[model samples]
Structure formats: structure tokens, C-alpha cells
Target: MQDSDSLRGFLFDNMPIRGQIVTLTSSYQEVLKRHEYPSNIACLLGEFLAAASLLGATLKQSARIILQARGSGALKTVMAECASDNRVRGIARGDFKVCATQTGFKDLFVDAVLAITIEPLQGQRYQGIVPLEGDNLSQCLMGYFAQSEQLPTSIKLAASTQESAGILVQQLPNHAPLEQSTTDWQTINLLIKTLRAKEQLHLTHNDQLYLLFKEHHVRLFDAKDMRFQCHCSRHRTARALISLGEPEIREIYLQQELIDMQCEFCGALYSFKKPFIDALLRDQNKALR
Candidate 1:
């Protein structure tokens, strides 16, 4: 049986190629439970979550990676975040009724742009943006790597309400002859193309890889657990409110006498009374001085 909520990295023993496979079951369900998304939107969000996990595995340091897309169509925005620790969270905002009827990526996200951001624990943050020019998420991500990283990468993604799964294969720089490297990469790409969405969602990592690369010497590492953990807290929420400035805070307080903040990813709610807001503002003022 396929492992649920886990990611595994594998390598081709004979070539400078590496791959990662990720499956999201419980984590995907958790995101769905937090919001009432339509079937199509839910599936798209699942793909984003799975993609984030695969990309997160490639990080060489402690960091967080976010995949976000904004558009003018039925699907207004979708974002997913994954940390080096394998924690994941995602959200989607849009016209659900209209999104439900839209299936193609282009139709669902007209004039959309996808952004990939990497934030390390102690380093500069980087982001890469690409216009949504492909038929699906996998193609768009492949375009990102081709344009930004200059690496030959192929990605396959599949998602349903029940689960989400993705596979990413990338060719690393090798000292081998160019012809040999290109041949090896092309061979692997052809094999990966045989993978179907139903197979990705249903097959175990070992079974899937072996089925695709049984002829090649493939080494798959131990599975790492993936989870749905929102990085939201009262402190972070308070910081965000402070960024809104005192004037905006006071106006909101005047209308409700209390300020309420809810995390879009986890739906956790935090409320602040006038006194707490006053203290926070005082602290901000002191810091400015």
C-alpha cells in the first residue's frame, strides 16, 4: 500500500539524476476541512501542496518554500507552503461556484502568475516568478526550473479530494560526456511520461518507482513524514496587526470594540481587546524611539 503523508527521495545509480515522490493524504484532507472549496479548486490546491513538498525536499538548508499563484479568473489565488521539516499548509480563494465549472488550468486562472519563494533560516530570501503558460501545474513548474534554475526537470502531479501525489525528476550537472548525459535524461523522461495520474495517486512509492525505473539502478531513501502544520500564532498575528498601523487598528477597534484575526490557512482565531491593542501600540512607539 502507498504510504500516506510522506515524501521520499531517490537517485539513479548510473546517472546524475535525482527524483522525489510525495503523497499527501491526511495533510490534503486537513486543508480541505479548513475551507469549503469546490472539487476542482480543492484538487488544484492539493497539487500545489504536493508540489511544495517535492520542492521543499530539494532544499539544502533549513528554510521554507512557498508556491503561490494569483489570477483574474474564477480561481483568484492559491498558495501552499512547505518547510524543510516537511510541515505543510495551503489555502485557496476564489469564486467556488464558477471554479467548480472550470477544469482547465488556463480557464481557471486567466492572466495568472506563479511565484516560487524560498526563505532560509539565516540567509537572503529569493523568489522566481513565471507567467502561467502551460496547461497544468506540472508544466508551469517545469518552465520555472528551465528558465530560472537551468536544470532539466520533469514533474508529474495528480490530485483528487482523497489524495494528492507528485513526482519530480531532475538531472544534475555531471562530468560525463554530454551525449551520455542527454541520452540518460531523455530515457528517464520517456519512462516518466508513462506514469498516469491514477497510478500516481494509488501506487506505493517503491512500486511506482520500480514500475517506472526497474531497468535502471534506482536508490530510494527512507520516507520522511509530511504534515499539515500552520505557522500561525498570536505573536505573528499581532505583528501583522501592528503593521497595519495605529490608525487602521483604532478604526477597527472603534467599530467592534475588539479586533479578531483568523488565519486563512488553519482557521485559528485570535482576538484582541482595546487594552491589549493599546499596550502593543505603546510598545511599537517605544521601539520607534
Candidate 2:
């Protein structure tokens, strides 16, 4: 079986096509434990987590990649992010009700928009939004790449109760001439098409890649660890409380006797009692002077 919380990247020796495979187990379970998600929603979030990790690997600089889907149907919004450090977190919100029949991507997310945002630690952020038109999340991502990136990309995603896994293949910019590139892309695409969700979840990374690309010249890289980490801390929460301004802070403190907050991404709790609130207000006032 594939190791949990690891991502593997590979490349073809003679072609410009590259690929990444990620399997999230402990990390996926950690995110799911924060909320009681329906089976369908949990599966979608798992796919998003894998996708975000795959995209984060492509970042040459320090940055975080966020994958979000907003829809008008039962599923309202789903969010996932993966930092350059391989820290991953995700959550989903919806007006969902479980049904006897299975729900497809289109059924749960009608008239949806899929957005991918890149936030660099030092530079301006970039975002691409596209229509969510597909039977599954993988197909929707393919459409996103086709419209927003104009890249020949293929993705396969699978989520079980215990783990989530995904694989992505893309044709790089520099390759042989257009005709040769097309032929190469087609061949790689066909090979990838043979992969199934069960195989992705059941096989080890090396075994899976070898099964798919053993006939070709491929080099696999060492796996990078991916983990469920929430960057939330009391210091950050204090800064956020200060941003709320003294009046709002005072109002909340007066009404509740304390300001309590919880990190939605993780179940960490932060509380500012009266004395803490007063100290924060004093600090803010002193900074204003």
C-alpha cells in the first residue's frame, strides 16, 4: 500500500510529460475528524486535498495553493489548501442531506465554479476561475486546465473511508514539435486512462507508477511528506482580535464575558478573557499613539 501522507513526482526520460501521485491517510482523517461530513462531501474534500498537494509541488517558490468549489445545489462550498511545506487543511459547507442514491459531482454541485488560487509568501496572489462542468472532480479539473491553462492535463482521484489518493499528468511546455508532442501526449494519456480509483488507493506509489509506466523510461523522485497542520496559534488569534477594533472587542467581551474562537480548519480553541481583552485593547491604543 502507498505510504500515508506522502507525494511522489515522476518524469519521462524522453518526453516532456510529468506526473505526481499523492496518497493522504492520516492527514485526510485529521481533516475529516474536524467535522461530520457526509460520505459524498468527505470524498470531495479528500480529492481537493490531494489536488492542492499536487499543485503545491509545482510551486518553485514558497507559496500556498487553494482549491475551492462553490455551487448553487446541495453542496455550497468546499475549500482546501496546501502550503509549500506540504501542510494541508480543508473543509466543506453545504445544505446537504444524504440520499439512498449516490450523488455525482454535477448532482451535488449545480452551476458551480471551480477556483484555484496561488498565494506567494512574498509576491502578489494569482487566481483562476472556471466553470465546474463535469461528472466528477477529476473531469472538472481537466476542464479548468483546458480553459485556464491550455495545458494537456489528466487527473485521477479516489477517496475511500480510510484514505484519499490522486494522480496528475501534464505535458510540459518544451518538447518535440507539435505533431510529435501530440502523439506523445496521446500515448501518455491513454496509459493514464487505465488507472482506476481502487488501484490508486490500494497500490504503493512505486508499484502503481511501475504498473502504468514500466514500458517507458521513467524516473521517480523521493516522496515528500504531507501533513495536516493548522497554522493557527494564540499569537495569531490575538492579532486577529486586535484587528476587530476596541469597540467590537469590548462589545463581545461585555456580552459574553470573554471572546471565544475556534479554528475551523482544526479544532483548536482560543479564548480571550476580560483581562486578556483589556490588555489587547491597551496594546492597540498604545500602538495608535
Candidate 3:
């Protein structure tokens, strides 16, 4: 597909290395439209969305990859999540005025902790946390890999007003001994580092990859589309209400004739009236029998 919002995976012909490049246009804009975020926070959320899509490409199950950062700085919390089906969404909550003045990672997120969570569809979940010590998100992610994954990984993330994009290159475990003189991870990383934000946001995915790895024996695969989707629905909301139980639901309904629930990710509202709540409770009770 020639769509701008797509993720492409590639690998070297000879080396034990793999990479993914993703560009977000509509998906990024969808997230921004849900909230009135400042330019800096919007850009940061875009970068996180791209990073999540890139990282989510490595998943083997119908799981999810969540990238989050929380701190006591201008940007209080940022979350980006991508499902195994390539559905992506993101949100940011923070001081917009403070974020407007910040330009650096540390400046925007002081005393921050970056956490990456991998939650499978039907298995154990995993999470890795690292201090936000780098100048940029890419560097912090590389540090996470170094400490938690013990892998040679490089990431270049960028975000603009109209689009967001990122590229990830990782050196896989070798299956056989290689000559010491062969090209190393550092060399490949240098090549990936040359990507610029303007190019990622403007250039086509194929063109961007060609510009970065044209010299290397790169094999590009078909692109996968990334979409902005929220998993929230009436059924899920009913389940949540059921978990709250009858008394809590009654109390909430008493405050207002209709209980309104707004989805943080999609801005969709779900309303529950007394009749609906009673029906839901009855259904939940029947299921418990």
C-alpha cells in the first residue's frame, strides 16, 4: 500500500538484524483531535504512537504493546498503545503551559520513569521500567533495551504537526559465528541515525528506507496499515459497571438519572439508564448462576 500511515518491516540479507519503520498521519491526527493538547505534548504523543507501532510489530500474539511515561514535570503522563492487529491509540495529560516552554526530554519530563508493557491476549503480561535519563525518547528506549532486554537496539523517533514516524533496528542473536571484521551493530546504527524528522514526515515509506539503507542489503516487506481504534464499547462498559456491583451503580444513578461514561481514548460517551443498569445486573447475575 502507498498509504502514508503504514508500518514496513525489513531485514538484512546476511546479518542477523531486523527493523521496522512506521509513519503515522491519520492515526496521529485522530488522537490529537480527541484532546486539546499543546504542540509539544501533541508531538510527544505522536512520537510515542510511532514508537508503540514499531515495537508492537515484534509481537507474536494478539496482544498489546504499551509505552508510557509518568513524571513530576510539565508532562505528567503520556500513554501510547498498539494492539497486535495494528490498532493504535494514544493520550497525553499534563500542564500545557509548562510543556509549551519545554524542549528537551528531561525538561519536559523531570524525574520521569519510562515503562514498556507487553500484555498478551491470553497469557502472562510483562513490563519493563527505566529512568528517563536520555535527551530524547529514542535514546531512552535504547537504554531500556540495554538494561531490560540485553539487545542491541536503535530507534529514531520524530514527530511533526502533520505526521509522526519512527524506525527501529535490532541485532538478533547470532546462530553461527561470524568473522570479527564483519559490519557491527554500531555501523548499522549510524546509518539509521541519519534519518531526519522532515524526511520521515514527508517522504514515502519506501523512499525513506531507501535513503537510509540503500547501501545495505535490505529486504523490505509489504507494509501493514496502522489504525486509530479504541477498544471501549457498551459491552465493555456494562462489564465495568457489573464489576462495580449493584450498590455502586445505584448510587451513581441516583446522582443523575442517566450515568454518562466518556472514553478517554476515543471521546465516545456511553450512557446507562436505570432500566439498562437493571438489565445488565440481571444478566450478570444469570451468568454467575
Candidate scoring better on TM-score of 1 and 3: 1
- Candidate 3: tens digits of C-alpha lDDT, residues 1-289: 2557899899888678899999999989999998998888888999999999999997768889999999997788999999999999999888888798888778898899999999998989999998987988999999999888566889999998788999998888886565531366767888888888888878887788789878778898998988999998998977776788788888887788988888889998998788988987888789889
Candidate closest to the true structure, highest lDDT = 1
Model 1 alpha-carbon drift over 4 Å, by segment: none
Say what the RMSD of model 3 is: 2.6
The TM-score obtained by model 2 is: 0.90
lDDT of 2 by residue, 1-289 (tens): 5478999899999999999999999999999998888887888899999999988887789999999999887678899999999999999987656421447667777788999999999999999999888888888889998887666899888998689999988899984799998898999888888998898998999888889988889988999999999988998988887888778877886678877788889989998788987887787789789
Candidate 3 pairs with clashing backbones: none
User: Which 10 residues in a row give candidate 3 its minimum summed lDDT?
Assistant: 175-184
Candidate 1 local lDDT, residue 231? 93
2 or 3, greater by TM-score: 2
lDDT of all predictions: 0.93, 0.87, 0.87
- Clashes per candidate (backbone, < 3 Å): 0, 0, 0
In the range 1-289, model 1's lDDT, one tens digit per residue, is 4589999999999999999999999999999998889888899999999999999998889999999999998788999999999999999998899898887788999899999999999999999998988989998999988889667899999999999999999999989999999999999999998999999999999999999999999999999999999999998999898999899888888799878899999999999889998998999899889
TM-score of every prediction relative to native: 0.97, 0.90, 0.89
> Where in model 3 is the C-alpha error above 4 Å?
1-3, 176-182, 239-251, 278-289
lDDT of 1 at 184: 95
Give lDDT for model 3. Answer: 0.87
